[model samples]
Target chain A: MTTATIIQSLASGLLMGLLYGLVAVGLALIFGLMDVTNFAHGEFLMLAMYMTFFLFAFFAIDPLLAAPLVGAAMFVFGAVAYLLVVRFAMRAKANIGMVQIFTTFGLAILMRGLAQYFFTPDYRSINVSWLGGKTISLGGVFLPVPQLVGALVSLAAFGALYFFIKKTDFGRALEATREDAGAVALVGIDKNKVFALGWGLGGALVGLAGAVMAMFFYIYPDVGASFALIAYVTVALGGFGSVFGAFAGGIIVGLVEASTALILPPSLKSVGIYAVYLLVVFIRPRGLFGSI
Target chain B: MDDAHSKRRLRDLIVAAVLTCIAALVPLFVKDVYVQNIMVLTLMYAALSQAWNILGGYCGQISLGHALYFGLGAYTTVLLFTKFGVLPWFGMLGGGLISAVIAMALGYPTFRLRGHYFVIATIVIAEIGFLLFHNWDWAGAALGIDIPVRGDSWAKFQFTRSKLPYYYFALVFCCVAWLVTWWLENSKWGYWWRAVKDNPEAAESLGVVVFNSKMGAAAVSAFLTAIGGAFYAMFVSYIDPESVMTFQFSLLMALPAVLGGIGTLWGPVLGAVILIPLTELTRSFIGGSGRGVDLILYGTVIVVISLARPEGLIGLFAKRRKEVAR
Candidate 1:
């Protein structure tokens, strides 16, 4: 109601928006690389959270420490998924687009089932990670420490991603492959290998987001379902296949979500996000930064 | 080729009629309530999926948000029947009209978005509807509606004693949807839709009203899907936001068409028949443990089928038939 409260909420919203960007950027990255939407990108997050949880639960490692481990593990997972599933999906001679959507969707379901089978579908959360239950006040606005750290981590990841895409040899190869997969092959790059690595890179990005999310969010089998839509919205709102657009989209979505919560009931908060998404796409069609 | 095509159309009609006759007699021979229940579900899904095929398959506008119309149909019927004492039959028509109008209205802006943008718009719109219904108190909010038992009569559309009538209604519904698809397949609109699907630019150049074709597909698809939702409300005799309108409902409606063969005439029916029973059996047998075995099997089948036979199992039959003729 007051400007002070508004400022505080907006601050928290900005942080959450950064994490949303992190969650969505991988989807944007993969879509940019190849026109396939994972549809299970959220499940990949769920998996990473579980990985972080297990590492914390058994090995006594903190989630902060577990982030890199989860990222590394998820890289392999993402690459293997591409090789085993997406590779076949890409080759589908008919209804290739639907095939891609459904295959990744199927994988998401299978992962959820497996999670339920092994993890018992019980909601688990790390109660005592160093930053889990802590909060900090900055200029009369209080922010959850986990989300703050998550925002910081997201910025760091984006920075690294910028450099990775703009500076590194692999990043250049990735850019080259994304521009024209067939032509990349003529230039002696293994197209499949590049794609698999792209998938891995995308996977690792979401993995980082998942680790931070595990600090505060409940870890469960179906947890991915809720956020997956938002991730999709963020990706599309920024314009599909543009990673920076995803980041911008995530910030816009988060701010809108926060402002909507201020006006509407919390339950109806998503209406604001969906409305903004529709409004944006309606006006621009391709999204804010989408290619013509 | 034209003669053969006409001959095939006649044979298709005959085959459909014969299949309907055979299906009607199925409950008479098999008296298990559980089996009958699954049969009812299969038929309902067949009808729903058929409606979805009109837009998603035939028109190549893949919508994963049919649940909005389904939930709307259900809500309209239950609200009208419970509050004003209107019969569900009239309610079904009313719901269908509302959904069709809404589809066209939403389609006005959304149809411009190509590919994922359009698909996600449908999802977001449906989600907005779901959230509103979830929070709307007068409409029973998230708890949903429970249809009171007025009587066991065809006029009332409620039969507690036996599901036979419901089964027959579902059968007719399925047949009508299939027949509609069959009819539209050869119509000017149908050809226009296919042309739009294959290549909208080319179709546009060929004088097809691409946007209108998509709008038409949306209206019809939403209308039919709404009818299915109304029937589902009556059949379940209870309606809730979660049950009728969710992301899962949209996916479930689309699954049969996808599994059987998208855009094909028999795809929805064939997919529903094969998938509905398998899901029911799996849920009862292995899913009872809460370990998600049913989901595992279901997911595996989806992945394998999409990979192995993206065209659908109907393609297998078509291939075999061609081989036999050869």
Candidate 2:
């Protein structure tokens, strides 16, 4: 392959990887804080995409502009979900793991069912004149405007989250709770509040991802299912609870997916990603950057 | 106390025998093709769910990618029959053996990962299978494969006029699955599985050979599921990656077990009996326009059951029975 083609693929993969990382980071954070794997996480992304779609369809709001609102709305939805469903499962006396797991699984189905009932399963896309039909050339590589915006926005969100986690008291408390809920409680931190906040933050991040993606991708109820699997793989490959690991793993997965197209059929791109996932799971279950 | 226990056991056996006879004779009395079809599907799901229970319930390894085995069984049996003119009965056994081997290979490395990691790995494995089959032209790729229709024949495992033969076939499979589950529940391996599930470290300390036990359970589970898949292929007379290897298929297999009672002997059967009819009826009545109401109902039932009764409907019955005994 020529250098230009390689560079172009790498560049596009990197951009896509950032968004993948953003989606996975939410899942990783939630898992880290609450020890609950939200199987409905992709549905959250689906909901956000629909939210963005509605905003664009009826109100003429650009997806970029709708991102924050959608994120905030999803944050509330996530918090409420945790309070109603997850909390109950957490409090169950027996079979805690099975109960919690199926709760989220059920929620995923419910969300998908609701979406199908309302949206009728048709693929919908936002028609943004500026984001659509535009590309920028950087040296030897061409970058699509929507993808560039998605990558930039995701990077900024990641940066903001890193700052919040490292520099803020709330973030420290969240980390503390993840380590030892009782210890955090001894220090006057409400463990439930921290857990709820973690869920909300996770939801908001994926919400932002969905909003940005809606600009360039199709919006459908089941669209989140495949991406959700990819995000889960990214989380596991990144070492479960580590945000930085998720980011790195996402990029690696993206690069692997893109580069494999050079030799493999496009339909089999996921095979390459899954093969890497299996290898990582067997060889280094802790992931590349995970301290845990 | 021994006499009471023996009496209860005899009564349970008699009840089971009677129920089996009734099920076997069902196709004769209820001649509606559609109802028979539903019964066949119910039996198929019961067998699949029981197969899942062997690993997910007994071994405490919630594999969300069971469709891998199911798909493998379907594809292998269909391919053997279509390509080599092998009879489906033999082809079904071949499919089960293939699934068992694959399960062992996968379970060896994956048993080390706990909980969600295992679940995720299973999903990835199934997706890989799905993608590979979807793209491979030899497997018919995205277009899928259709088995040529033939007149009713026991050798081909095909029925043209009546669904009776298929019903009996499904009933027999379902019975065998239940019997296997019953045998496992009474075996030493059953105790080993329960121990590992309750506390792996403790079980290991006591020399439970956790890896081998889990692998065995997975192999058995996959074998049974594959047989179900093979039957499904013949029953449907077509096979595709989307139908057999998707995550949705895995979910459907697990749903009956989860809804009825994971790890329990009759849970899968009860779950299948209840859920299949509910979905089928909903689909016939309002499915065309409503599209997803049944799914919504399923989601609601699952959520409520998980939170309120994780042991499922059987658990509730057991509780009431205990109360009555007291």
Candidate 3:
């Protein structure tokens, strides 16, 4: 292969990988703190995409400009979801796995159904004057402007999140709760509030990723279904609850996906990804960075 | 006490006899082709879900990848019949054995993972299966395979113009699956499985070979589910990876057992009876314009039941009976 071609593929893969990492961090955080997988996590991403679309369609605002608004809306949605569905499932004395699984699975179907009802299952995309149909030439390779911006936004979001978790007292409390909820409670921290905040932050992160993606990707009711499995694989490969691990895992998965496409048939590219996932699961269940 | 026990046994026998007779006779009375079709579908789901219950409910290992086995069984039988002219009867048995072996192979490595990790593994494995089949030309790839239409022949397991034979075939399979579950519920394996499910570490401490017991359950479950898959291949006379190996198919197989009562012997049957008809009626009444209403209803039901009554409908009945006795 030519060096230029290889550079181009790697550049695109790196950009895509950043967004994938953003998609998985929310799932990892929620799982680490709440101990629920949130099967409907992808649907939340779908919601954000739709939210971005509506904001653009109704007010003629650019999706990038409205990303924070969508993120804030999703934060409230996530907190409320935790209070209503997840808390009750956690409280159940028997069959905790069954209850938790179906609750989120049900929510996923519910959200998809509601989206279809409202949006009619048609694929939607945002077309901004600045973002659409533009590319930047980097050395000898070309990079799509929308994708580049999305990747930068994801990196910024990741950096901000890392700073918050590492530097802030609330972030420390969140981490403590994840490590040992009973111990955190003994130290006068409210475990419930910490969990709710985790959900909110997780939701906001995914929502921002969704808005960024909406600038370039197709938007639909079932759009989340495609990304949901990939995000789950990222979370597991990253070691369940570790945000940095999820980010690293995402890049690894993206690289594997893009590089394999050069060798395997398009249909079999996913097979390669799944094979990697199975290997990681069998060989290292704790993931690359997970402690337990 | 002896007299009461005998009387209860006699009553159970009578109930079983009556149900069997009704199952045999109902298709004859239902003249509508649509109703018979629904019955066939309901019975197929009943068998498939019962097979799932063996692993997911009794053993407490939730596999969202059961479609892998189901598709394996279907493809095995279809390929053998189309290539070598093997009778579907023997092909069905071959399919089941293949599925059982595959399940055992997957189960050994996966059963080590607990809870959600196990669940994720199942999904990934199933996706792998889908990808492989979607690209494999011998299995017909994405275009799928169609069994050549043959006139009504018991040897080929193809029926022309009569839904009755297919209905009876499905009913028999469903009954067999139910009987196996009933037998397992009373057997030593059943006790071992319950122990493992309730607390694996404790069960191991008490001399149970936890891995072996789980593998045994997985084999039996895969075997029965494969038979249902083979039957489905003949019933539909068409097979595709998208239809048979998708995550949606896996979830649908598990839904009935969850809805009726996961661990109960007759939960799958009860759940199939309720769900299949509900799906059909919604499809007819709401039609195409109301595409997602049925799914919305199903999601609502599942969420409400999981939240308010994790034990399901049968569990509610059992609870009432205990209260009355007290």
Task: Highest TM-score: give the candidate number.
Answer: 1
lDDT tens digits, residue span A1-292, model 2: 8988888998999999999998889999998887889989999999999999999899898888999999999899889889888889898776788788889988998898899998988999987645876899999589998999999998899899999999999999988999999888998998888888888999999999999999988998888887999999999999888888888988998898888876687778788889998998788766666655
List clashing residue pairs in candidate 2. Answer: none
Q: Better model by lDDT, 1 or 3?
A: 1
Error of 2 at B122 (Å): 0.7
- CAPRI tier for the interface of model 2: medium
What local lDDT score does residue A240 receive in model 3, on the 0 to 100 scale? 86
Strongest candidate by lDDT:
1
Q: What is the interface RMSD of each candidate, in Å?
A: 0.6, 1.3, 1.3
List DockQ, one per candidate, in order. 0.86, 0.69, 0.67
Residue ranges of candidate 1 with Cα displaced over 4 Å:
none
Q: Order the candidates by DockQ, highest first — what do you get?
A: 1, 2, 3
**What local lDDT does model 1 show for residue B278?**
90
Docking class of 1: high
Compose the digit string of candidate 3's lDDT tens values, residues A1-292. Answer: 8888878888888888888999989999999886889999999999999999999999987988989999999999998988888888888766777888888998898888888887878988887636877998989789998888988988998899999998999999988888899999998999888988998999999999999889888999889999999899888888888889889988888887878777799778777667787888788767778765
TM-score of the second chain, each candidate in turn, equals 0.99, 0.96, 0.94
- Tens-place lDDT per residue, model 1, A110-198, is 99999989898899999989987899989888999999999999999999999999999999999998899989999899989999999
Candidate with better DockQ, 1 vs 3: 1
List the candidate 3 regions with Cα displacement exceeding 4 Å.
A186-188, B1-17
User: In model 1, how well does chain A match by TM-score?
Assistant: 0.99
